[model samples]
Target: MRQQLASMLREARHAAGMTIDQVAAHLLCSPAKISRMETGRRPASQRDVRDLCDHYSVDTEKREQMMALAQDGRRRSWWDEYELPRGYSNLIGMEAAASSMRDFKSSTINGLLQTEEYAREVISSYFLPANPALIDQLVAVRMERQRAVLRRDPLPDMQFVLDEAALRRVVGGPVVMEEQLGRLLAITSELPSATIQVLSLRRGAHAAMDTTFTVLDFPPGTPLKPVVHVEDVFGDMKLERQEDVDNARQVFQRAADAALSPGESRELLEEIRAQYEREQPPER
Candidate 1:
């Protein structure tokens, strides 16, 4: 929501042929303040929005529309209660509004599809010497995010392409993994708009071998650009440039092309689950 407002404001500013400094001068504010407003680093006040719209000579109807967007941007998301890192919160905001998404995971299950036990285990592993309360909060946030797939008015179309190694990684334990696999199957059955595919090891050394990323597509009426999100140990990065987004899109397509079909992927998942069940220890 904030991104949508920022994009529209930036576009209007550019169309007006006014420099940031010039806008700052007109509004009697520092250039940094103007920059933050256009980049969504800070909230834009109603008066500030009106002043900018007037300066840009935006039609009254469009100006009102932008103001409405600004108002919407002020509403807090449920994730806000978790006190997430800035980068994570920004990505969640974008994800909440995305109409479709393509995800590639090379190391582990995507957060959106993780079952509660799987998510708890993954979080515990990462935040070793973990705080139990914090771990619970993190798990809750992830579970809430899964609602995007189940959203009904206009369901989000989602495709996940996973490296086969991810399935074999053995998160939690055999029983936990078995449950996770079952959850994945349930998700596919319940959400027709969601798909899961596996890129077998046999398709060795493919593109995007070292990266895990997601590309989010928004509805057409807004000025929001398609964004590619990349996360690493350092932090998360949002790629908005046309070239970067295009490259990410192509990478996802290539990986998807190399993955097993949805039916085949489900069959493989079942086989893996059976292996886990067989390996489970007998009653003590």
Candidate 2:
């Protein structure tokens, strides 16, 4: 929401043919503050937005739209209640507004598609040094994010491409993995907007071997541009520069092309789930 507002303000300023310095002077603020507002680093107050709109001479309808966006931006999301890790809040904010998403995971299932148990195990295992309470909160946050795909009014189009190794690896033991795979199969069968593809080991040495990233696309008429989010052991980074977004898109397309067809992917997932089920201890 903040990004959308910021993009609109930036575009309006550009259309007005004014430099950051000129706007700052008119608003009696430092250029740095205007820059931060335009880049979404700082929230724009209602007065600030009004002042900008007045300066930009934006059309009445567009001005109202930007003001409404600013108002919406001030409201906190459900994720805001939790103390998210550094860099995660921004990712969640973007995800919440995205109309579609493309995820490529080399290590495990994408968070949006993860089952609750799978997410809990992954969080607990990865953040071993963190408090148990914090891990649980993180798990809840991830589970809540699934709503983006599940919501009916405006369901998000999602594409997930997983490396064969991610599916084959026994995460959280056989029982957990079995359930996770089952969840994946259910999601594929139930959600027409969701597509899951697997890149086989046979087609080795593909792009994106070094990272797991997601690309988010917003709806038409939104000033917000596509963003590429990359997560690693250190932290998460949101890439917004045109070149960076373009490169990420190309990389994801290449990886998708190398992956099996959706039907084939489902077949493979079923096979792997069977393998995990076989490895599980018999129930009493």
Candidate 3:
């Protein structure tokens, strides 16, 4: 709801032909505050919403809606339990609400497909020299998201395209990678909505090679807008414009087309898992 409100408020401001400074002046707040509020970076207060609504001469019905949105922003969510970076929290929140999603991961297994052991290694490495407790919390959050999004009924129209390098990478060592690969193989049968494809090395240099991204689609008739999410060194970015979503979708289609079919992906996963199995030392 916070995101929805943010979009609505931003659109309303444009419709009213007011600048951020203008709204900030009316709300008696900083321009940065108004900017953040419109971008979902800062939560808008009741007074902020009411003052802005009145300044724009908004209709009573619309004012009520914006007020309700401000209040809705305060409501607790499942991801709120864990203290997480705002971007990641928002990503998970959006993921939960999405009715369909496309995930294109280049370096590691998609979070939804990671095993607990694999996740631990990935998290531990990302936040190196960090607290074990924080690692546990982060891992716990991922596991919960997996169950909530993937291990349930009425699953999202999910499509995951894993680069061949991701499959071959020895993340968390041989055992963990093997288990993670096994999970990928099992997921196709476990969840009918999910389709896993492998972007083969044979297809060298695809459209999404430069970066890893995801496009999440919200259900129709919802205020929530579909967003194209990109994760880079700087952090994650959420692109909600229609053109951005369209471009991301086009890139995904090319990558998907270049990828191995579901059955072929399973075969490749099996081959990799077997290699990892062989690499395991002799039992005591």
Candidate 4:
């Protein structure tokens, strides 16, 4: 909501033939503040929206619309309850609202598809020596996101291109990985718009081998720009420039082309699950 508001604010400013410096002078604020608000680095308050609307001589109805958007931008979202890094929290919120998403997961399942146990292990491993309570909170947040995935109105497009390496990597051990694969099957089945393609090890040295990222598209006719999320061991980042977004999409398409078909991916998943199942301890 904040992002959409930011875009609208920019468009309004552009339409009014005002420069950031001009607006800042009128509003008695620094040009940097105006720039941050327009770009969504800092959210614009309702008063700010009102002042801009008045300055632009916008119609009454349009002013109301911008005002409502500003209010919604300030509202707390579901992910705000937990003590989370702001970037990660924003990513979850954005993922939930995206109209479509293409995710290339190099090392693990997407958080929205992870089982509770799998999530716990992943979180605990990364934030080593974490308090037990924190791990529980993190896992709970992941599960909540999964529940939201099912309940979302007007289901979004979900495309996941998973590396076979991620599928084979033992996350929490044999049994855990086995159950995690089963959860993936179940969750993907539940999402009617979901598509999964597995990139086998045989398809070596692909275009996306060096990155794990997700590209998100917003609804048509909205001002929300498409975004690319690049994630790594260090952290995550949001790339909003059109060129960066286009480049990410091109890379994703190339990688997806070499991946297994949806049917083939499911077969591979089942085969790996059986392997893990067989590795389980024998009954006494």
Candidate 5:
């Protein structure tokens, strides 16, 4: 929200026909500092807002409002209380608001695509003597998040690259895994804006290793920069540095290049389903 407020403040300043250098001179700061504050690259300090109000002749009420917004923007989100297993509540919140997303998963179904059964099995393994009711609530939340995948108008364009190992993991036994793979194929086949690519084992020791990350890209010039979410043993982290984000983007491209085309991936999934069926005895 800080970033959002900064963008709004910058727009207001721009509309007033003021340049960053001019504002800097009026506030007795460098152009870079003004630029950072306006772009949300730097947090808006109380003094900075006060100085800007003095320079721009903003009314006391308006100045106080902006200061309050800046304060609220820096405060952590309330979702941190959920204590998500992978500590992905923050990332989920961001993804829920993104205009587009590029995800690379190396060892499991992307969270959005995991079947309820598969998800339950995965989460069950994570929490010992797990509370069934809590697991159900978490699953519901996960399912709620899946709504993003089905959104039609103004839906966030999604690009997913999954490693072959993810497909072969057998998360919830063959039947469950087969159903999950079929669901994945079906979604990609039906959603024109969604793309799914499977990175084959043949690619070997690629940029993605046994790791997963997502790059959430918003509209250009927005206060929030494209961020990379990296999931680790401890928790998930949001990476915002330009260089790191750029590197993640490059790695995603490489992984996508190595993955099977969408059409081929769907076909491969079907073949695996057939193999699973062949190994199972007839029902009664």
Candidate 6:
């Protein structure tokens, strides 16, 4: 597979009438980098694929395939052997390729929505034995996944419905929780493609009460089926069956309906943030 990709890169480069040195100069990288990408020694980055496609004047279809191949290379990550925990790599891959995503978390803040401090606290609490380097790597990976929320065209439309209690639970203490809530509001306000809804405790229990899950929607003409990721401590359940997927979709819809709207959710966060502030005594 790598060889085929390498051959494609070389073919595209040759067709453009551009020398390796020129391409390397355009990319602002070493000649060896281009050589390795063409030889399959290193997987192509999305930027590399885009630049080459433009230089080669490839059609949309061919360009999309090459870029998708580059993305797929990252999906089969080698991070598993490092004991990075189960299901995380799968989550990253799903987030990377999903055209739309809906998440309902009844417990702590979802990793995708967490601030670095909140994430660090959560990781440390769960992986008590992990060293600083591993913790830092895990946090970095989580932040990288969050970038999906900001990507341009072909970016996923993200909707998150969090239980209101989750907002006030103080996952990493009042300071971290406050920062997280503020970050959530700021992100949603800035990203028109994203939505954050809060499922208030007063609304009573709903379909997403017992468990947390995510539904990932794919772009049109995608080869694989749409999947639902039901997360648990042991491992996650990847549901691809039509019936199961439908059921999860229905659950998410109901939860969204019960949750506060984007505007109201922001107001809710502001209120919580203020309340936490009031409860915190001023430093001497």
Clashing pairs in 2: none
Better of 4 and 6 by lDDT: 4
Best by TM-score: 1
What's every prediction's RMSD, in angstroms? 1.9, 2.3, 2.0, 2.5, 7.2, 10.9
Arranged by lDDT with the best first, the candidates are 2, 1, 4, 3, 6, 5
Per-candidate TM-scores read 0.92, 0.90, 0.92, 0.89, 0.73, 0.71
Model 3, runs deviating above 4 Å: 57-64, 151-153
Instruction: Say which prediction, candidate 2 or candidate 3, comes out ahead on lDDT.
Output: 2
Model 5 lDDT-worst window of ten: 78-87
Clashes by residue pair, model 4: none
What are the clashing pairs of model 5?
none
Per-residue lDDT value at 244 in model 5: 92
Model 1 over residues 167-268: C-alpha lDDT tens digits?
Answer: 898898888998988988888798888999999988999997899999999998867889999977688888888999999999999999999999999999
Candidate 3: the clashing residue pairs are: none
Report the candidate with higher lDDT, 5 versus 6: 6
> After superposition, which runs of candidate 2 have C-alpha atoms over 4 Å from their true positions?
13-36, 39-41
Q: Write the per-residue lDDT of candidate 2 for residues 1-284, one digit (tens) a residue.
A: 88789888888998999999999998899999999888776789888999999988899999898889889888876877887764687788787788999999998898878888888887887774778888877888887877744774677898999999998888888999999999999999888989999999889899977789999999987878898999887888988888999999999999999999999999999999999999999899
Q: Across residues 189-263, which tens digit of lDDT does each residue of candidate 5 receive?
A: 777878998888887888888579999987674545688999765777778788999999999998898788988
Per-residue lDDT tens digits of candidate 6, residues 1-284? 34345657887887888899998998789999998887555778888889889878988987888887788665545343345543565566567667888899997778877899998988787675768997888887777667654554655788999998788787777777778888998888777877899999999978889989999886775543577899887787767678999999999999999998888988999999888777666799
lDDT of 3 by residue, 1-284 (tens): 77777877888898899999987887677999888888877888888888778787889987888899899888877877777877787788788778999999999888888899998988898775788999999999999988888855678999999999988888878888888888888898888899999999989889999879889988886667889989875788888889999999999999999999999988888998999999977899
lDDT of 1 at 39: 73
Residue 211 displacement in candidate 2 (angstroms)? 1.9
Q: Local distance difference test, per candidate?
A: 0.87, 0.87, 0.86, 0.86, 0.77, 0.79
